[model samples]
Target chain A: MYIVVAYDVSEDHVRNKVAETLAAYGLQRIQRSVFAGRLPPALVKELAEKLRRVTRGANADVIIIRVDKRALDTAVRIGPALPREGNVHLH
Target chain B: MYIVVAYDVSEDHVRNKVAETLAAYGLQRIQRSVFAGRLPPALVKELAEKLRRVTRGANADVIIIRVDKRALDTAVRIGPALPREGNVHLH
Candidate 1:
């Protein structure tokens, strides 16, 4: 499934660690606190466990919202935002 | 359709304005720079126009990804994140 991971952590260092973990999993950073990409359900489950370990005893929360790939390809772009995949070709 | 809006803007005020706009449209902030909610397609289009206008002279980008409600309900929650709705339970 395609997922959008968004984190809100109280500490900067912890936040960076969380971001790094997401990046390590090959998720694209779409916003300061958000990342998105496609992953198999098993990997997502693994990520959830990894995230739990990273945020242990910290005031942090991360949500991995499932996104439909079709929806992502036809993303409703606003402003000058460009899709990472240039060939998506949606209006 | 349910949508998840994520933004990256250059200026603080502009970013706040963008967030305010999203909030006014009843979107829930899931992270500092991300919001998610259900909106009619017409409202989503209207939001795209408003975002464009707000970011006219700014170096900013916003992407709204459509989400399936079933997908959302079965969100792959990670860390200590809790769903906003306490009743819509899932594991």
Candidate 2:
């Protein structure tokens, strides 16, 4: 399973900490505020709880999205398709 | 259908233009390089082709992900769950 985590954080310190926490979970930063990678559902649940604590009281909104590869393989690319980071791309 | 569009473009001009094009298609920016919203499958194919054209060159890689709301409703939030734009929530 692929998890795409996106957040809207008001405090810089909390935001950075959230990013680090996501990275610690082995999620790759696909965008500035979006981190994504492959992880099991159980792990995702665990990390979501951790992130919730790390982001507590920062006036932040974080959403974790789960995408099956069937959807990703159908990914329509508009430019030179570079190899994506994990099971994100069909090898 | 919910479509999540993510891109990695090396050029600022192309990136901005691509973002504008996505916005024109009713896709909202959930993150810096990520956009998501409600769009039908046929429209997704159409917009994907357009994005491919707009993002041509500039050493960019763009991906479009489709997610069902059954999955979004399962979204676990750690902070204040602000009403997400479009068909991204259980409401």
Highest-lDDT candidate = 1
CAPRI-style quality class for the chain A–B interface of candidate 2: medium
How close to the true structure is residue B75 of candidate 2, measured as C-alpha lDDT?
62
Error of 2 at A4 (Å): 1.8
lDDT of 1 by residue, B1-91 (tens): 8887888899898999999999999988866787888889999989988988998888887888888877767676554556462111322
DockQ score for candidate 1: 0.67
DockQ of each: 0.67, 0.55
Write down the lDDT of every candidate, Cα atoms only.
Answer: 0.78, 0.74
A1-91 per-residue lDDT for model 2 (tens digits): 7877877788999999999999998888755676777888889879988987888777887778887767765656555545542224431
Residue B51 displacement (Å), model 2? 1.3
Measured over the true interface residues after superposition, the C-alpha RMSD of each candidate is: 2.1, 3.2
lDDT, model 1, position A58: 86
Per-residue alpha-carbon lDDT of model 1 for A1-91, expressed as tens digits? 7787878899888899999999998888866788888889999989888988998988887878887778777886655555452212322
Question: Model 1 — interface RMS deviation?
Answer: 2.1
